[model samples]
Target: MSWSIKNWRRNQILQREGIPDYIWQKLISMRCLKGLNPDELMRLRECATLFLHDKQINGAHELEITDEMRASIALQACILILNLDLDYYRNWVEIIVYPGEFILDYDYADEFGVVHHIHRIAAGEAWSAGPVILSWQDTIHTATRSGHNVVIHEFAHKIDMLHEGANGCPELHANMSAYTWHEVFSQAYAQFCHQVDKRQETIIDPYAAESPAEFFAVLSEVFFELPLITQQHFPSVYEQLALFYRQDPAQRWR
Candidate 1:
């Protein structure tokens, strides 16, 4: 089926179910979505409905999944793909929600061929072609205007994974230049790492220094939540992200 036809069919099916007004109200309460036009808001609602239908969103550890909770998560996740489509998220079929932080067993090999195992606490995680696990506590707390959002951060990693692995570079549009992406992000990441080493209190999270992939995800959080800081600190990276996401959050807020 054509893209338009598929989308229309999805919309038709969703119209029968009908998203609750409270869901839309809760979504607009989010700072990132405050200034969206009516038309854009409608599209976002449709996309979110499609996301909820296609993905299995389950609450873990005896936590009950509320309609509000699902709507909030689905709204946030679908926002990233407003200009794109559900196909971007085809690799994942489930969104598991925990009450709080979750633990993951980490295994690694040493130079002497030794192996080690460790447990790492995480707010959210996204595996290549696997489910996305998140902490509902963190998700609700992270919806502020501050530059922190596990939903956006993990989804950004999924986007990066679309082109090979999550290496800070997702597939670019025809007009975007990969050379520019590499040059700009390389310079920005190095500088950010240097600042982190210097013990500077930076607005961008220090966790971004972990890896190139992490740098991209962390910056994506900033792009949507605190777009002004992103535009001021690394305008080129923000420009690239705006082009990729097809949204100008700073302008919307302004």
Candidate 2:
């Protein structure tokens, strides 16, 4: 769609089905959303309203969906795209919320072409060009915790997927340097992996050591939730993230 038409439709959605005041107030109070000025908050609200209008959020395993639940999810998802456009989440339309950690059963081919069936409990999962699946229990529990947000983690994957399937590099803006992004993230990921291998206590999640893609997603969680930790530990990576997301969360957090 053209930018003008999209903007018109978004305005209509904001006018016709804006978020309730109480829910918006509650969302703004979230730690992850702290330090947004009035104008940013307004833009976030409009983006969230458009998000709720465009996406389908449904409960699984007989879990009932409520307005508060929907708003909570939408608000966090919108935060990732607050400085950018909501088009970052384009081509996805569903968010399935389970009551808690749900089982993931799937088959995957290993690097050697060996197919394996795996089953495990998962708090959240995001598919390329598909829905975002989450455990609502974990979502609420982690939302308030510093450096832990399942919603942001999964949505960050979606953003990373927009480039070339989440290899720790999203599509950079024209002004941003791809070489610098790789140099910074590759070093940070390696160092972080070494820390994890040594079982060293760290502020960021160890799960990030799993892969470069995971490093990006998990670092994204830290970037927004505990910007200071990200900046302190990986200053260069933090700068790249600030440029990519187009927001200085550390500044906002301060």
Candidate 3:
């Protein structure tokens, strides 16, 4: 029974790999794929196609991972890495999915070694060397509204973790200056925290206040979803993300 199930899964995946262009074209037409021009969008589609072929996603809660569903998730996730090498996501293999939001459990010891248990209910999460988890409801909410991009946000976190810990800094390209990145991001992050503390209304989401890591993840959502605001408010950070992601989204999204 196990061998038969594995053989069937292999066949299904091979057939899905060469997914047609029009399917991706329709995806690009999605409001969420905004901020990228025609050429960039096409590149996103190609990279997404390859990504769909390469990665494995398992559906839990009796929900099956369909071709359309996987394609939709892959399209947005890999677009961030399209300009860079696929090796960025190479360390991770599987993606886990549930029909809806799920709960996570973990136990930790503080600096004092006082053991504590933590439980979190979240729509998505990225593991350092493990699977990316998602909720089907949130996945379908892509590009609609509510200022969320679970896949992009989680994968951005993965990108951040690629270098070391998720301290909001990802590995940079040859052209990016490490000092300049730190200066701009650190200053902006402090100001954002200050603004949030003062209760100042800001265009970017308030969730960005959680921490530098949250700021990077939240800003990544806006960097693609609401590029104009990101560029207008944090031009330097916007430029840095553009360079890091290797795509000028502000121009296209606007």
The candidate scoring highest on TM-score is: 2
Give all candidates' CA lDDT scores.
Answer: 0.87, 0.91, 0.83
> What is candidate 1's lDDT per residue for 1-254, written digit by digit as tens?
69999778877879865569967775677765767888888888888888888888898999999888888888888888988878889867999999999999988675588999968999999988898999999998985537889998998888889997789999999989999999999999999999999999887989999999999999988888888889998898999899989999889878
Tell how far residue 53 is off in model 2, in angstroms: 1.0
Q: After superposing candidate 1, which stretches have Cα over 4 Å from the reference?
A: 1-8, 108-118
Q: Put down candidate 2 lDDT per residue, 28-70, tens digits, no spaces.
A: 8877798999999999888888899989999999999999899
List of clashing residue pairs for candidate 1: none
Lowest lDDT sum, 10 consecutive residues, model 3, at 10-19
Q: Per-residue CA lDDT of candidate 3, range 23-55, in tens? A: 665676655576676787666766776677778
Enumerate residue pairs that collide in model 2.
none
- Model 3, stretches more than 4 Å misplaced? 1-16, 35-38, 109-116
List the candidate 2 regions with Cα displacement exceeding 4 Å.
Answer: 1-6, 110-114
TM-score of each candidate structure, all chains considered together:
0.92, 0.95, 0.87
Clashes of each: 0, 0, 1
Q: What value of lDDT does candidate 1 attain over all alpha carbons?
A: 0.87
